[model samples]
Target: MSNNGDVFVIGGVEHMGHVGMMHGVDPNPHMSLYAAKASGMMGLTAEMLGKMHGITREAQDAFGVRSHRLAHQATVEGNFKDEIIPMQGYDENGFLKMYDFDETIRPETTLESLAALKPAFNPKG
Candidate 1:
């Protein structure tokens, strides 16, 4: 929602409702994970990124760092506690009760690691 304009185009492409032209997907609800991952890995077209937001490499790096931080914060603040399902579910009565939050959120992502990641999108070398 923060980047509405960018999301809009991707959403519009989805709203077109053409399956054949869309790589065998109905572009109305949500894009397939395969498509999203492929697109993410392949990176965005220069024209597409340009039309959405004038994001630079530096900005992208900062965004990634901030996103990691936000995830950590959300977990720490118990905002996602309800969303988590704990393991070892059997209680004394053999009833399943969740007792912990998922600890998959990374709070220690470094700038070096972020820099090492491949670019998700770019315009020119």
Candidate 2:
């Protein structure tokens, strides 16, 4: 629920974040140009680039787990107080809502759980 009396709930969508803006024009050929193949090529390119630097799924997942853990720890320890600004407002139903921290972090993620995910970019893997 938003402060503007609009009830907003996020459903699940993955590729929308990548192939979303189909009508927009940009200097990057990746945007609005070859919209269908853009995502695959971009991911493959990124995976190749990472491979050049010796980054594998294990390394990537380890970094992600470490990242979430560090981020949660930092937030809990008030390390981001200087950068974070708390916002207080009313919900769509007029209930008071206070937001002071990141809500998207999965702090309890484990390396084993992360390993369950298939490598999307690395086709050979």
* Highest-lDDT candidate: 2
Model 1, span 6-125: residue lDDT tens: 633221123334333335434443554545524532134443554466766566667768877998898889897786666666667999877685444567876778777674444242
Give per-model TM-scores. 0.44, 0.54
In candidate 2, what are the lDDT values of residues 1-125, reduced to their tens digit? Answer: 01244555544434546654333434475554655433444556567556666767787788789989998999999997886678987778999999787766789999999988777755575
Q: Give candidate 1's whole-model lDDT.
A: 0.57
> In model 1, where do residues sit more than 4 Å from their true spots?
1-47, 50-52, 85-104, 120-125
- Give me the displacement of residue 77 in model 2, in angstroms: 0.7
Model 1 lowest lDDT segment of ten: 7-16
| Model 1 CA lDDT for position 26 | 45
